[model samples]
Target: MSNDFYTSSILPYAAIIIKICRAYTNTQEDFEDYYQEVCLQIWRSNENFRGQSEWSTWIYRLTLNVCLTLLKKNSKHHVTSNHLPDVVAEDNRTFDDESLNHLYNAIKQLSEVDRAVILLYLEEKTYQEIAEIIGTNPNNIGVRVKRIKERLKKILDGKVN
Candidate 1:
């Protein structure tokens, strides 16, 4: 049943999971671990689907929540990894352009919440949709997006930490 569900539901939406997980993790091993964990949580919580939103929207909210929760939990116990990859997590195939690579690399440095906001914005989601997914007031999204973009610009220009 689970395998069937995965094939029918999750496989089709795997790219979103990969994008969210890759954004949340630094190393390839951590990316694999985060992806596995997000899939597990999605499976475990499948029964709670209330049909209140599009299946894709539910997946996005779940992916973001799982990534944020795991990031917070992991941050408390910091461990330096000698095997860390030189480049911060970017799916080379997805971002083949040199400039996109730099932009995405800069994105990875953003606060987790900002990264979530910008990711949704890049997906062309409306402020209302982003607010709904992130569980915030719609009015706040515009301001947050402006700030996030400015920060990304600074990061790209080597102007800010």
Candidate 2:
């Protein structure tokens, strides 16, 4: 498929893509590498997209699958925040954004499956849709999201002090 496919279809979601990449990988280089890999994978698999879901949802599944597979195969070297560009901390003010970042950081501490659920939840995905993509029941997603929210709030409250 031509690059235009991504330019038109997937490029609009780059920020979410980047956030997901950063949430998984620590270093800028590693994140970029993984982001490129995701793009390539999406492009390669574009033709096979059977229109079973929204394109973004499909991309999210592909991204989660790719990142989880990579994580299972190789553990990335943990990097301190100093190594990342300052922008990682940008958009990180305001109670909600700060709370969201804290929540994201805490969510990163969970298993890959949990992390995916939290990310989808933060993205405002419905439990049914999240369940559909992750192959879990909607009821379980509801419970998991509630637990994730409580965990995030605890982390946020701790950081506020």
Candidate 3:
């Protein structure tokens, strides 16, 4: 990727990529790998974009697809572990907000498709936008978002086993 293009095209949209990668990954190392792969994939696949949608929307779909694909591949080769290790912060630092941590931990428990839906929802994407991205009906997106929200609330409240 050219430095200028990356700075202009990818850097501006990196937050969406990072958040999706973070939601799908349990550890920092895995997060870095997924993030790298997403960036590389976006660069490799940019030419295929036909400009039918906004750039941000295209990036969102690309990021989600890459993360989900890598996740599925990893699950097949690795034994599933119930416990996620504590994420060690760089320079021995920690995030300032506890609720954010709780939220992300809860988000991590959602099914892959639900995770993508909720992430897009949290990003304030419209139901139609989410539907377009996920290839579902707009009406279904509302119902799914409602259900996912309720499930997340239960998880946060310690009601869901």
Report clashes for each candidate as comma-separated counts.
0, 0, 0
lDDT score, residue 114, model 2? 80
Local error of candidate 3 at 91, Å? Answer: 14
The residue-by-residue lDDT of candidate 2 on 16-81, one tens digit each, is: 787777677655676778888899999888889999898888888888888887766555544333
TM-score of each model, in listed order: 0.87, 0.78, 0.91
> How much RMSD separates candidate 1 from the native structure?
3.3
Candidate 3: which stretches are off by over 4 Å? Answer: 81-95
Instruction: Kindly report which residue stretches of model 1 are placed more than 4 angstroms away from their true locations once superposed.
Output: 79-94
Alpha-carbon RMSD of each model: 3.3, 4.8, 2.7
Tens-digit lDDT string for candidate 1 (1-161): 37898998788889878888877777677778888888898899988989999888898899999999888888789873422244543443336688876776777788788888898898888999999898899999999999999988888787964
Clashing pairs in 1: none
**Predicted structure with the largest lDDT when compared to the true one:** 3
Query: Model 3 misses residue 63 by how many Å?
Result: 0.4
C-alpha lDDT (0 to 100) for residue 14 of candidate 1:
93
Give the poorly placed runs of model 2, Cα more than 4 Å off.
76-100, 159-161
